[model samples]
Target: MNQSQQPDAADPKRRDILRWTVGLSAGLVLAPLAGCDGGSDDSFSATVDTLPEAPRIVAKNGLIDIDLEAAYAHNSVQLAASAQNAYPGESTQQATDLRSYNGAMLAPTLQLNAGDTLRVLLHNKLPGNDTKYSSLPYLNYQNSTNLHFHGLHVNPGIIRPGVYGDYVVDTPDAGVVPGASRQHEIHLPADHTNGVYWYHPHLHGSTTTQVANGMFGAILVNTPRNDFDLPDDVRDRVIFVHRLNLSDGGRSDNLYDYVNNKNSAFMLNGVYQPTIVMRPGEIQNWHFLNSDVFYPFNPVLDEHTLWQYARDGNSFDRVFRPVNAATSVQMDGRHWPGNVLYPGNRSSVLVQASQTPGTYYLRAAKAPSSTGEEIVARIVVEGRPVEAALPSPHRLPLYNAHQPITDAELAQHGGKTRAVILAMLNKDSDLLVQPIPAGEEWFIPPGDGVSLTDTVFATGNVGTKLAPFQSDLAVTQTIALNAVEEWTLYNLNGYPHPFHIHVNDCYVVKVNGEDIEPYWADTIPLAPNGTSDQPTSITFRSRFTDFTGKFVWHCHALDHEDLGMMELVEVRT
Candidate 1:
């Protein structure tokens, strides 16, 4: 029951139903109806049948088993910089054991047809690192991890539930936590969409550690049965983007320090040392995913339009949809056409063949700004047309416009909220001369300038030790906000820290609580530590209902969190 499958060209009635399904009822009507057919050759299908045939890779519908074995040493292999693996000369670091993979970790590009069953066997070899000592949400440290089939319409609770220590909504003995040597089955609905989906560890606390060890992969779905309606000229390629932050030692035996302080330096798949190269005049569709901590990878297209095909493996039929959180987006309305892939997420982008064949560079954009980084891949579109390329259904949906928040919405909430500052605690420096008495909430007075950075509150004691419940602000320990209070986060650090809260999908109420031109995110990217502002900030609103847990609010950067950058958030409902 693949949701992205189109109606049969021979059956007009089913075709109309599918059109309506892909348009208005993406989740409900389209999903269930597609599932009822049970991968049958019936009218209710989840693929397009009118296009050319897809190149065969694995079986149309089968399982791809991946295992993580512990390695005490390092492995070396030559990586391919070209599509056909012609120039495999560079020797790079490899995962010594099942527990790790590093220095350009590779995963097979999964290609499946609609109604295909994706059964995966994820084995965890390095045990006993669950939650007690690990920083990530522990599914089961003894043999914990998750297999979240990102963007697929399936039950997450049941798929690849690794061993459970914490961060699991489903308890063990319920089949959510896998015992040692046990394998879990993830069932994808027949009507699931044909876009770029992905798999990774979803164990709450331990996600950082597991993913850092190269425990992530990409999932690509072909149209109904992988044999239907695929264009000849363009072939789908799955590119898994990962950040390798390994220590000086070998990869396999190295401990996964979720709190690694260094920023990500390597891009595993297409942007690694040996960049991906493609033939000219041959259209290539790229499916990308960023398995980094929380940094957003924005790729650039200079000569090409970078036509988007899908997000999160699901096809977007209509011109508009709402993106309220960090999720997958399929640009093409179908599986054949590719789309744009965002950082910390997945996307399908199609690079059409160029009339003039030459080397074209694809670069990665830095987070929280428009600036891009080094080339990720090079397209030498010189070869003849491979096959009949399927036309990407590039309908500029209005929903895409609403994505990443708009300027007007940011302006409306700007200046309507109060500013809050983020700074580290050290003994001695108190420009405000405000002492943090024990057992009280802290509060720093907003300076007279439009931005918080302009206002100086604390200074000098970079060597001071912060007593418990003692902060630079006057309020001390508790951060109390009156009902309906709008707050703006004025990040004083120089490095990027993604700010996140529990329960509520926060709108970018304002940029620095004032109208400004900048990107908006649920996780505000703070400046790097030790750098002076150029202050960055964001505002958000909350109703404060039904979510009265001892939740946490902090920078999504795992290193920052371990260094006491996180705080307890108790929203009084």
Candidate 2:
């Protein structure tokens, strides 16, 4: 069977799986208030079992060379009982079980410098027949996978010709077929942002399944800027969060089963309620990566203020303390009292241990019932003070600080504006037959008798009929070299989506018509319409100053993206 052929959505065999997987009838609405519990309906009791802390592995040289081989593993988790009453018609308890992964439940951390080259040799050791339970009529290559360097400005593909041609940037084609292996080369520019980034499987059809099984890792790019200075005695920790729902036999029947049943365990660094010992008056830098396929978490450390200085690997001009911190001078529109980490987002926060020692809970203040307000980790401050004074916020050198795009530059070269609407199409939508824009090419999968809507499953371009990093489709939206362009991403979907662009970082200028502090980020959240009829929009500006090639823009909700919500853009010299 052709790998790119569109799956027959109407096939009787396909219907069984489609009914259980593809449809999400309602949109995810934002929960009111910061600490309110969004209640659950399972019957199994929550566990309190805890595991030993996992080791943090940092890269030795400038190169991040590693091998990722898929395999199965067992992990234990403890789900705490809810203090708030369960919502009507919701489950009161849910059981916990061990799940599988590529190796361990969580991959190791891959650390590097700003100007480093990442050479990864990923071996596809996953069983080729893992898709035997799949219901999709087309190729359900669950064992096939690839890697995406999230939030990195790196080349998507090597130069070649024709199908494997140079500058084509074939993102989907980069996948490693089952029983095969592939080498991925990524070069981070000399001035790449210095903070937290991540890597995960991006194979279109099996992305959710692979990531759900824990094929992810952290990539930290170090810098010498004083603004990001930390005390020599301070400990740096990576807290990678994931939500998993395993059955009695320690496996899920389908990729969407976790979504439908709401039986999940929220984990930090692959362990439940892992305890971290700290000294009173000591400060620590905690880097967080939200690798969940769909869930969003707003984290708060009780009685502790989070001094956030970075987002999506890009550091801000000044450190931002929570709005309620006593030392916080003033509140910037971009500053918040807590950190909200959506899917595909990364953040670094400075946490100071209380002067008086005690145990504190670091948990998500807001999350869905499957993993709502659960205690993620425990911080025990039982030792004497390591530092006499509390750490002060640092004013770091921002990325591209010397090449700030001024108003004059905008007026001169930022005239190009592109509008994008993120919407979902059904059987009744006109987009099913909408023609591609004049002179703009549409990516047709390798199969005959496939409709545009059918192509959505194959290419992930439902309402827009666009393809992932297809150079021809992006020609119409070509950006001139070194040009600063303003782009507005409107969310027409019923739920919120995180808009992410590759190869460039953007500063959010306005959201929902309200002016905001221009903060640099590679991923920005697009709010849902809510009760309003009009879709919410966010405007941002990005400078295409450096390298030119094909890259992609898409919803950071990996599931939404896999089902068709990505487009290609080109920077032409």
Candidate 3:
């Protein structure tokens, strides 16, 4: 039966049993009973809702001008009355409300050429006042909002002198306040890569809450890199995988409640287990984005092989065939055998439909520890098989290519090398935890433990202000425009974290002191620090070229980023 019908078929006695047996004051009674670990184990029933196809918006004449807005709208997904009541204030009433681009549940896909100009007049129609439950002590900017052109090598914004305030192009200028409008101009360079990119709310402090409310969309930059392409009749799909916590009614102010309550649903295009139809042996290009704030999705087609062609919006010269390796040096340390899209990661893969032509499942083999083996999409293969041969991997053009930093270039432009440590800040912690030194301008939100701090630099009077950090001890690494520098990132936490940098991409040179094939990437995975024996570290070289201003590098885990695991870097002229 379809998802909408399953709820009606549910035994009414189940609700009565839950309501009477489990008291309302206890927060979430169903989450635990429902196995709220965010996994697809049999204990948790699969969602039966039909998947909705995401809408697309293609550019014309190398230009895309649109009116984007962040406002409240209704989602069709139905939640139990008890689930809705778990939320505190207006959030309970706005359980169906979502903050979207152009009022779409899953914002429209923007298609453009490499050199296209994107002009968006963003109108922030969010409520002027914070949610009625805003009295809580924490940073919440529900009423204020901005936009970020993720993965595009465009100017974030220009910052002027005293005449103008700190105007960051990537982030909004004081945000598009309630009923206010702001214009964002982005010019994609002629040499920009042809691949998949995305956009979302980027205002700090409230990014987690706003994004959790579903304020994001996709951007596809088309370029003529490969003359040979998928059959004209082949269907191309963009899958935005995101998570929504239903317990707190999907409210920005109650995100903490959602996190603490562990009430969430994994969805594709805002629906559960939608069926995608394909023909036997048909090769289709699938662009996937992990829009979830903290979940890392390891997608696996039940019996099919996913040939990956791009990573983080940059196309590689050849398709990557998953292989088993004993050590990290054999293949890229970031990706597993199959293409795994970590949080904030994007990938384009070519899926060859099974020749047998039957129903199969697209499952997330590795998700957040709490969630296991969850089904993301259902593949229904039928119809006659398509006769086509897979394209030669080597013949694919390198849509985005970056020359490795030669020894000579490194020697000439190399600046100060820095070592940063990612750690926890709990007082009872002995896991390489570091406490914030005295007299730093940064304040740790109550109960925050995750932090990114520099080990070599001291508090205050260091680095450029453009790349400043919240705490005096969290030093900003300064780099001259066009400078080349090596950064060594150490992970002291118990779990793995994906590190991502803005503005410029980097080349991975070594991992755990072992050299590997260098490749261009904006994000890299760092292994966890396990039991005293295995210490984790990653070293990469980056060139600060082209557009220069203030940008940030942080853990892609949105929750960690919101907590404090982020640092600013300056590319000064």
Candidate 4:
């Protein structure tokens, strides 16, 4: 064979030790608190290390049986560098006690195949919570928690039958409260749509506080690897992004803060400004997950291209740049498209290190101009050249829902449309989620959907909005099984909300009635309404095929979800 005909290096899908750097992104609310926000381009001597990947529990013989425990890490946990960010969930002065899954700040990553039986015996060893933060009297029960399989299409049934696959309601199963343990068995079907998903506590009151304090991890199921036909030298990395804030004296940062393993102002795999060492022509598959309790992050690698592979755990038909994702952080003074990852969103991409590279950074350009830019990570491409080729991401044929919901599928559901108003009937910062399930009388008197004499709750309207879970209420939104439906998500409030749904991924059809490329995702940003008469809206179609029972759709800004911007829906067979 000629020089051009030589085969590429093997794809081992493993990581080798390489030195790197990471920095914390200073958000507007966090800028003042992150005085010691880890190393930057200057602190090479602080600590150069391999990205900290949480230990993986891979399935063996089609079964992954593991004992997972949750407890408080009392002592300070940090990297070897003194310059690292101090991640004390309570105080900026010292590393305080924080909750963790299996004693890990980032929790264990579960690797499984499509037909794997994931049996986990979760032991909740944490202490009881007695603090209340908001209007809801039950908002501070931090000890009461349950695991929700973020994107897995599993049954949310009773815990006695098999396990609590994705069930989060407080009725039958009261969740794994303090000192209690529960075994969860989730069996992925032989054709489960596979890629990267996540697991986190979903108990109503403490969901945001716990997740922000580092109770989340990744789940890689049936990665479409052999379909790529690559060798064994390729590197597969999980880049889980999170925020760890500190409270100084009486001035506390947002309650949305979570204590990740790393104490950086902003973190990637529990470290500040983590660097990924690579050689020219080397390819790496990265699972980019945004686990921040609130806010979306738009990441731009200085010179690299994030070849889109999948979104929300479903693979695309082919490789393509995601809509609005910037190819690179352009130095030109022009505004570029956004590759935004809202809270609870994940993007899997393939990046090839340029042949002659120096130092590149994974940076973000947020809004409000002044506090918009921060470096997420550093990528140093200088080493022995590895001859490698990136295959097409579209080649992977996932199970069902790999493609867009077709027009034929929508026709079966009969022109049925449901609406939800994203408003703030309370404080400005608070998010109000008013679920307007179909069949409700549309009384057009300003609040429009349903007419109420006094409280909307008096007429089973949920009192205008759900507050702090209100766990013992009737679910007005009931979805029919084996049907595809379009949903109108309206952002009536002036700010944006990352709308997310469980058990199914939806294809974005339009924004404010304007048709756009149908992008499939479990989470998508509903643009701000800006107090306009015509609120910002997103229309999406989703198919609820296999698995039925209770699940939720909520604002992915987790704090907002904790407050009330979440709705429970039962899919009846």
Clashes of each: 89, 9, 9, 24
Task: Say which prediction, candidate 1 or candidate 3, comes out ahead on TM-score.
Answer: 3
Candidates in order have lDDT scores of 0.40, 0.56, 0.59, 0.61
Per-residue lDDT for 1-573 in model 3, tens only?
211111211123343322212212211111111211214443222333244544444455556667788888766653222211111201123346666776778676665666677777678887764444323223345557777777777775443322111223232225666898777767778777777778877665567777877888887776212223555544466788877765445454434544554545466777655667666787777788888887766777777777777778766656565411222123244432125566778877778888896778777664323265556667777665677777777765564336676667778896556666665434333332144344432333344322332322111221222111344445565789888888777765655577888767777777766776666677776755522345477778887878767767777776666555677777789
Across residues 105-183, which tens digit of lDDT does each residue of candidate 4 receive?
5676776777778777788887765553322345556677788889887877764764667778762125787888887
Model 4 TM: 0.78
RMSD to native for every prediction?
13.1, 13.8, 12.4, 10.0
Better of 3 and 4 by TM-score: 4
Tell me the spans in candidate 1 whose CA falls farther than 4 Å from its real position: 1-95, 98-123, 129-199, 202-206, 219-233, 247-249, 252-265, 270-282, 294-298, 308-348, 365-373, 385-490, 499-509, 514-535, 540-554, 561-573
Between candidates 1 and 2, which one is better according to lDDT?
2
What is the per-residue lDDT of model 1 for residues 1-573, given as tens digits with 9 covering 90 to 100?
A: 432233321223543333222111112112111112215533222322111111112322233333333222244423322222112223354333324422224544344654555544444444454343322222124235444444443432333355321122322112224333434444444444455555555443344555666665555565321222444334445556555554334342212343332333435452343333434445566566666664555565547656554444434443222221122222211210112223344555666656665655555544342233544444444433344353536542223322443445435434244455555443233523445454332222233121212222221212332321123332222223223335566555654455554333344445543543222123444433323335555566543332233444555454333233444454442
In model 2, the runs with Cα more than 4 Å from the true position are: 1-61, 76-102, 129-139, 159-174, 223-227, 258-263, 323-338, 367-372, 401-404, 430-477, 530-532
lDDT of 3 at 506: 75
Candidate number with greatest TM-score: 4
